[model samples]
Target: MRRFLIIAGLSLAALFGLAAPSFATVSEPDDDPLIDPAPCVNAATDGDADNVIAVCTPLIDQEKTGKPERVKALLARAAAFDRKQQFDRALGDYDTALMLDATKPDGFNARGELRRRQGNRPGALADFAAAVKRDPQHQAARANYKSLALELERLGAQLAVKNKPSFDCKQAKRPVQKAICADPELADLDREIDAAHQAKLRHAAAGTVSRRALLRAQDAYLAERNAAFGRSTDELRAAMKARLRQLRGGKAD
Candidate 1:
């Protein structure tokens, strides 16, 4: 049963297109009091899982430890648990750390990755989004969010292949429109992008410059698509995904 559970967990990670956790540590200042004062800090950051857990557990248990110190220890121990595939324990610690300090992008990113590996796509998505919101420059969170969004889109497309395209095929005037209508996958993508765009508009404040910019950008994207002749299905899909990312407040490809 233990082996089976391990295999099941690994299989779920594969299905989500998630790689194993890289266990990367953010660098702290050499003379920083946080690092220098904490006995478990180095072991937590760089040691093996056993040592990390052993050293961090004490720090976490200390009632007098500062909130920041305790949160760091929790994250370290959580990462150790993650490496050991003790996902429940890892998630608990991550939750505690985040509760103590929701501003930590790394905590959210780590928890998001763990949730993704455990096949909790919605949870992963929420965590990743939170991480990015907390720190837009967080590369890991951005990458994870983009990848998961694309995967989710692909899954939705697969499930709704039988649905009609956003545009009418019977009145299709352009070759690109005709092509999109002919291919179920491309049609699904068209519908998805359209829905996503409309949703973004619905949420945008009226008369705002951001809303106007979005409209202009979307119009430009459409104009470019209409002008491009003989673009492949793959090209169209890529364009749609880029637009979707932009709509989701991510940097365009």
Candidate 2:
């Protein structure tokens, strides 16, 4: 029994001795005050960009710094770099901070603003969307997302109508109509001329002399375009431009 007790005590001592080094290793980092991010936070609050970077860089580089402290340091440094107009460095720090901790919406919003300033509209839109998705109450992110979305929507609508003519291309069978449908610029001119002519007709009283003259002028214009289109496309474009101008002038002749 005595020999068994001796063996058990020795085993317990060996186990504690092995764990002591690990405990010390874990606690040693906590003893170092320099690795704490308090100084970096203070510099950032002071708006002293150079001091923020100087203080935060060392904390960010230290492996002994905890993940939360490292993220704080990285964010502070990023803001400092932004104030200094060191855009690339600021972006790098923002990216690193977000990668380390993606739970914060402010980080995403900041990155989105940076991307916007860099003329990365699509990237900024995506980041703003992410920030809003993460926190619906984030007013800045929501405002940015809404503004960008409306701009894109307007641009999309313009592009959608850019190539469309007033008439349906599928039903066009005449040579001039087919030619107009085939060329985007000619189609646009034709559409504009038609719109201007229609507007003038709408303004004129029905059965009036002016309305009859406008109708005759439009018929004559179409007849001339159909007859001249086979000769030269350049002439067709010029005729269309002249017709558009005449119609827009609100003159019957």
Candidate 3:
């Protein structure tokens, strides 16, 4: 169980690296806590605790009625993108819908699917968890909850590898083990990440990249990689992480 949690955590951390590769078929929601808060939840209510409650309750009891016409349009467009198997666009629509109205768990669930398709399992789990938490009775939220368990398991295993000596990049002179060797994308990512970690290590490795630098790279990487791979979030993230660790000199388990 602990192992699973570790992998999930690590993969989630690495997910943004390969997100541009594309994974739109995963069929989950795309709610980013970092980018934009849910619009429904973010609406400026009367500031009364009760007013806030009343505002949120409608999204559940009224069945998306709280969502504005624009919100609905965005969601519809996003759904259409899903139908066309254009996950990146679908994810964009989902983001717009959530930004327009955060109360819709369905939007969150839908966006989570896009993240999952992009190999962002941790993100998918977070969005799925958020969706169900906001509305326990939501069918989509319920389904997404069940969908994330496997992702969690895969994340855990990858995390174990992350913590092991076999996967540690900082300590490595050469990534000799085939078990440790990463794929092409991961290889590129590894080099990029290594550049970053090297700068942070001890006095900083020569030609090192900073944490701030990685943050910038992370954003572009997520959008680009998610659009590129289109693999199961956890699997793709795991593969990417192995390479990224090598690149960034991420410490092995």
Candidate 4:
């Protein structure tokens, strides 16, 4: 009976040893605290700026945290700073996030928008372009690029014509030309008259009697202006206005 009890005790010990390994395996830590990203993500999504900064900063500061988790923390804090109108801090975060991983379009797009608000158009355009290149179907980036490009084009055209006379100011040897170049209102009037006259010439058939008559009228007007400019500047301006009206099919007077 004592030998039977000893055998039973040995069998129980062997069974317990076999189960111990399984228990250890089950009890092992599933997630490492150093690299855990839940707190940063939650704070960014649900918390305000102050909360996000407080919660995410620790994760970002952790050296053991993976690049992906670090980027998330940085982006969250950046957005929080942006909401508080701390643009410089927000930019620093965005720069760090992009430097960590340039593949994400969201980072580029967000940075582009911030740069645009700061009036850094060139920087904004480059960022938007990078975002679009990474993800062609990125709607917001595409829209921003197209809208800014059109605005710049329109501005360029306006700037091209601004305060410019019909005749070149550099070649203004005549008193009338110098006067037109000197006064913005006179320059605008000169451009209008020249544009109207050119339009009439384009509409009139070449080598026809009407075209010949139009040319003659233009020559007469130029001769009269050249002869009258030094005498009465007001008269020259009035004559130019009247000529413009006539070219537009208005009354000759």
Candidate 5:
């Protein structure tokens, strides 16, 4: 499975002509301390969630700091809130920061990541797209947008499959098939694979050696996947992600 994933990744990279940037995980905001309120910045950036909230609250309430410095504090505090899973507060701060400085991509990217974690795919997609529009070279935003696009696509395919399945869910006897039917995430992956297979077939030229080889490879992959029922869902998801990258003609982000 690992070898197949590697091969799929290579195929995607070849198709795209360049390797896609890796997706960025959520992390603390970049620190830019103010000379006048250096302690507020330090507390917001380096302290724990509670300390960040306590210190930033005053700085925010006072409104004495410059807009740039205040935005930095807001972002740092927002990151701290996010770390503590205070999503509403974090989102509010991110909103304020963006409102204060609408030209920058940082706030949008940060909020998009937060929205993704909050299971708001549409909001995350919009925010990521906005970030990319503001700065096309922003790798984080691009990766986030691509990842969300793929997920939403898979979800749509899943819904379609649920309405008109290629396989009979009621009569699914195999462990792998049962697992796929029982888990929505896995079901979505299954639908994505089916869609990719059909797409490949539709695009393949008749009587072509390469097309024949590609079909064989796809069949082999499906067979192996079906037989590996004991594998964890995480493993299956990773494989499906690699396959999706191949189907999309782009390296994994």
Candidate 6:
């Protein structure tokens, strides 16, 4: 009896010793300063369930942290990423915010923009379609459609430019053999690229969109990327401007 009691006491002591440590260290989730609010969207005051606090919190921390002063910061950041051409991150933030609050037309619009920039035409179109559906009165969406129409015209222009012969260049450091670095005609080409890029940005900022608009945005982006063949900055500018005017309802003809 004495031996059994002693053995039981030893076992109980060991169990308590192990269990006490664990219990003492019990982690309080609320006490965790890192515990972000659920949804974890860039602009969301409270995060979303489709992307809950646990999963999205780390994503938010990795890309976007802290509550936005307003939705503006989130939108602006999305635009900046789209500008620097970081499409995936921008879309993640936008989608997260939209998931948190679908009523915010801007979130849907921005996600659509990122999708457009990323070359996800179908995704972008869907997002824009949703935005327009959510808010039919959105002016940005109206302007975006016009911009897309111009982009379609611009695609034709780009094909024409591609067929046009590149001029002689004095640029020695050109990476490509067929580059048009310093040609006098470069001025026009530069404008076209800029226009396409700006149109892309305008679409991103539109806060609403359409399928036609999404396709045009994609075409414009491709045109812009293809323009970088040691082309003259002046030419880039010209291409961009012409394209911009075209997007703004001007006839390229």
Output the number of the lDDT-best candidate. 2
Task: Give the per-residue lDDT digits (tens) of candidate 4, residues 187-219.
Answer: 877888778778888988999998899889988
Q: Backbone clash tally for model 5?
A: 0
Candidate 4, which ten residues in sequence have the lowest lDDT sum? 23-32
> What global local distance difference test value does model 3 have?
0.60
Candidate 2 has what TM-score? Answer: 0.57
Identify the runs in model 4 with alpha carbons over 4 angstroms from their true place: 1-35, 166-177, 183-253
In candidate 5, which residue ranges exceed 4 Å CA deviation? 1-35, 44-47, 167-253
Per-residue alpha-carbon lDDT of model 3 for 201-250, expressed as tens digits? 54534455765565556566545544555434445556557646644556
Candidate 5 residue 23 C-alpha distance from true site, Å: 68
Error of 4 at 108 (Å): 0.4
lDDT of 3 at 233: 46
In candidate 1, which residue ranges exceed 4 Å CA deviation?
Answer: 1-37, 162-253
Ranking by TM-score: 4, 2, 5, 1, 3, 6
TM-score of 5: 0.52
lDDT of 4 at 183: 77
lDDT scores of the candidates, listed in order: 0.85, 0.87, 0.60, 0.86, 0.82, 0.55
RMSD (CA, Å), each prediction: 26.0, 9.4, 34.1, 10.2, 32.3, 18.0
Error of 2 at 181 (Å): 2.9
Q: Candidate 2, residues 13-108: lDDT per residue as tens digits?
A: 999998885533444455546576788889989999989989989898887889989988888899889989999999999999999999878889
| Model 3 weakest 10-residue run by lDDT | 31-40
lDDT of 4 at 32: 38
Q: How far out, in Å, is residue 228 in model 3?
A: 45
